[model samples]
Target chain A: MTSTIVTAAILAIGDELLSGRTKDKNIGHLADVLLLSGIDLKEVRIVADEQDAIVEALNALRKRYTYVFTSGGIGPTHDDITADAVSAAFGLTCEHDAEAMRLLAEMYKRREMEFTEARQRMARMPKGARHIANPVSTAPGFIVDNVYVMAGVPQVFQAMVDNILPELQKGSHLLTRSLPCPYGEGDIGTLLGAIQKAHPETSIGSYPKYDGQRFSTELVVRARDEAKLDAAANAISDMIRGLDAARAGSNPGPEA
Target chain B: MTSTIVTAAILAIGDELLSGRTKDKNIGHLADVLLLSGIDLKEVRIVADEQDAIVEALNALRKRYTYVFTSGGIGPTHDDITADAVSAAFGLTCEHDAEAMRLLAEMYKRREMEFTEARQRMARMPKGARHIANPVSTAPGFIVDNVYVMAGVPQVFQAMVDNILPELQKGSHLLTRSLPCPYGEGDIGTLLGAIQKAHPETSIGSYPKYDGQRFSTELVVRARDEAKLDAAANAISDMIRGLDAARAGSNPGPEA
Candidate 1:
């Protein structure tokens, strides 16, 4: 057994996000990236910039999952308290990082922007943390134990993740194959149940779609084992083809 | 002064969500609803279907936030373990409800779908739970204590929330005002600092937007008090207009 059990979780922190002022696109994008990298995304939580809430979520998620990624609330605003809450969760003190401050100072100097106390607020880091570089923004993200903290902005968060993903351990990639079936979910439920029983290791999903005129369904088969996945796909494809043939022989009804 | 403080948190469950197979959208929608209803969405967490992860998140978030909403893993599949996990969180047993079974049986009969053992799985509810009717889907959502368990599908989740939102208590709504300035964030940094100091109760945010022809910034002012929010907005707007007039006379250049 390859022990294909790599789990991860995401904690999104921000009042704006929870208030729906900013729609979070990072969760889905990160999920796809982590899945393709052979890591099972297990859970995601969105919390406001409250200290107690952040601390509770952090402690719970970090202990259960192999990796925990948090986004937002790392800005210079008064409500940007994710760093402090993260520190509290781990029982560590947040301090200004010399390297992060240097980076911020250098960037501000280059742009002729004032490095005010508010701007310097971005340089604070939880004690005993490693920095996750942000290419798009001067403010650097940090990693404490299994938790990876990044900015909430989609562009900045993605850039930081790109810099960090290559270094993490990945399990066997999950393989999926899907075939469109011109049948209703009711008609294919029995077949799907049988298929699921036949391939215990593989997971089968049925998605129904109605595009104006036709009622179509997509049967998806997924597995971590490449060979088993392919075999399951072939079996499903054959079953669908047989169903289509049988439907043709009968008096085909009007398009549903 | 009426002191109204409303808080909510979201708990997203399932291994598929963390593995990035499904992009969770219910959190954002719920966040919007809660905010509009004057409830501060305090926190959200995505955890696996594992008993420990779900139980820990529930206990922590429930104790900290006023209300907690959960989505996903409430289905007929073996991986659908939210009901069991929620029951464990409350130190209760998972039991089949006669009312829930009645609802499920009626739904199945209406759809002409078989009431199989798998379908019966939908009737399992956490001990001492109230039902949340799902207008879009047959499977009804449930509430235990302060935690509301909803479906994972976006459309269905929205419908379920719509049915439940009006019943929940709402606090006084927060007000927001914005003033657009034709200056960069760097230009208005000092002025924003002074504005923050002047109105300690408000949250002022500067967002930079780059159109093809020009660069401009928008200063958003937010507060729970309408009078304070209006006062801050007017002051910020006046300051930005002054800067605009001064710059036009001094530079006499095209907007960029």
Candidate 2:
């Protein structure tokens, strides 16, 4: 870990998610975006639309990580209480912001639609929070106490993330190198463990993929240092080749 | 909420998920299964492949909820440390079980494959844990304390869940009634709030969806009691009809 390592967590809030009615797309999208920004997405928590659950998760994640990004419950509805929960988390009252209300009202007015109180609810945010622009929808997300509250809709949530990511601090990009090993994980586990111990800084991940007939492992080495990453990848490749050679030497022909 | 309500939290352990390489399919599948079993899937957390991260999350979730279900990190690989993490969380040793070894040996012998030590890693589990059968794959998941550990592969995970769900305790099923209101949530929020107040037992969730031109709210009322659920659903329907009538009466015509 480096001194400038930026860590983040995502709090996906929705009852639909808890009920298994909605398969989450935001978590993966946000994870990719955060990784590109050199932010380590250390943890992710999904909770229901309940205020206490959201508030509790928000406070815990916000304290533990460098930044906490929340999706869902920022819509114009009664159950969309993300802003309120965020406000409650920080001991602040949620009130409609002048600027957010102005944007929403202007948009609704231009469209000849009712700027109903529920529509105005999207403008509500915790005190002392900065508004995050939502390019897809006019309603803005808000950032309070290192927590960036965004909409739950995939498109809207993605737009808000795109708008906010550039402003966040970045660290050294974590680079990765992968090698496809034609052997089962058991065949390479001990050697892989040794290699991982040798290269402590580079995080080694052995992912097993079993085909219909056999299993193969994909060894991925990730690190901030390019040199160390390359070294680890090369070492893993050599280990695989050595294993193959030994197997071939012992059994010259096809297995009986 | 009833005294017999069995709550659960899923700890999805995998670096691939955190890195955005694999979109999770296990959480939703497990959630649906738990719901059918009358288990409330209250929370879900995703963490990296690190043992400390997995152990910390496992400990927190296992203690907080009635059951903590985990998926991923239990495999024959260097980074598959879920078993070790579970053992550490409960202060138990992760050693290969005689029965698990016997099963694996028999399966491998039948398939005419090598029974390497790495392959034996799947047999390792926390001391005093009960094995959960995996119909798809022979590798068994284990239940330590209230934590049910399963594999990451979607098919295998689903199979393990099916094998385990019937044996766990069940609670009263939470049934839901959804009312699709064409009116925006703001138009019905106040009334919905009042209705929710009248029926405190039901959980009213207001989910808003935008169709480019207008926003509609999906008001979902969930409760264990069928009578209370029906009562709340009826109240919501009446409110929607009243709003539509009011809107038509005020506008008089459908022109701009």
Candidate 3:
């Protein structure tokens, strides 16, 4: 059975994220979740709340990727302008979505709170949009076309993602194996390239680290095929062992 | 005297970042540091360790911003294709620089380590590029045109930034004032929008938070002029206070 290749892009819109006032916890969290679902998150853009920037990035990402997920700029604040941007990107008029308005109004009434005009702004979305139910704050995020507008708040973002993920079509699972090698990238860079070339089905990456005292590398192998991934990983492990043995056998003096 | 405005963009490169194997710490850290230096960080792009992807992103960002800072994919590993991408972006030939080769050889010699061919790959850079010395590791990062290609390791990245920042031309500082409100964005979003319009010189943003028990908001005012920033901040403070008073004054029943 062949699996569908689903791809996604993230548009993290906020002035605070750009200004570094708020460190983005959403990008990493979503990246992890999307990968587990076999959806490849190809790229991510962090832009300010400017309508033009948001619209420009949104349109560019939406047309290319299977899905474009946006976080932040969906709050009740003046800076929360994702809805307007989404509408402008698709040339649709933004208005108060009827179902969203009704749901929010009922929520406010249940809490003994006034559904003020500002609160109504939370219900504003592009025409023909559907709501992504917000069980936390009651103001729902909206889905216009393939763009899933989500709240920037970490808790709300996670909840909305949890609510919406299962509805999407599935892709083949992406499996990975991590092997820690007691060697630097320099020790295995050449061989790793050869291994990657040999196992065309698997993707291999080498990451080097220096910890004050010594250097080490983490080699990660990824593939859709379980056998290919395992074989590549085993090859990498053997390569590291061979290199260690060779180094131990040779004791050449430093050529100053 | 008017201040010169400098803009910057960050291109964080790596597959591990996209796969969620490594959570990005460099983007936030660099954004924070760049803002304090009077540089307006406009956009950030996180892309996988692919050549065409890196080249496209680098070219796009380098042309638009005053400076484009790139992190990751600069290691000696086979997957570290950033240097090649950098070369391709500007059509420069990638080769081992004499200075970088000398530096790495000396460093390895001093440590009684072999400067193997694989280790020499660290010296590969675009022709005519200058080295950004790595204090933590012996391998050097390079600068080509306005793009600063730095190491992915957080410690090395920070050290390179610290070393490079002071030499660049300075711009007028961006100042900010933050005011906390004991209300949600819905309570003050409209009024905050009005305040933003009134203070055209300052950028005002309202961020709402839900702590599971209560709601609160943080209003931030930013401007190059300290006086303008504080003025906008005071206006927001007064508006929040007025909103609080109005809430306490009215005892409206829930309209079911």
Better of 1 and 3 by TM-score: 3
Candidate 2, residues A1-256: lDDT per residue as tens digits? 4537899999999989889877888998989888888899999999988899888888888999999999998877667888889999999989999999999999888978788876788889987799899876788999886889998888788889989977899967999888889987767887888899999989999877766656787888999988899999999989988988887896677652
True contacts kept of 3: 0.77
Estimate every model's Cα lDDT from 0 to 1: 0.78, 0.86, 0.88
Question: How do all the candidates rank in terms of lDDT, highest first?
Answer: 3, 2, 1
Error of 2 at B141 (Å): 1.4
- As a whole number from 0 to 100, the lDDT of residue A128 in candidate 3 is 91
Computed on C-alphas against the true complex, the DockQ of each candidate is: 0.36, 0.64, 0.70
Residue lDDT tens for model 3, B11-45:
99998888888888899888888878889999999
Candidate 2, residue A95: the lDDT equals: 94
Q: Please name the candidate that would achieve the greatest TM-score relative to the true structure.
A: 3
Score residue B150 of candidate 2 by CA lDDT: 93
Q: TM-score of every model? A: 0.82, 0.92, 0.95
Off by over 4 Å in 2: A1-3, A250-256, B1-3, B250-256
TM-score order, best first, reads 3, 2, 1
Q: Which segments of model 1 are wrong by more than 4 Å?
A: A1-5, A90-93, A179-221, A230-256, B110-112, B181-194, B205-218, B238-256
**Candidate 2 per-residue lDDT over residues B102-145, each given as its tens digit:** 99999989988788887899899987899999766688999987
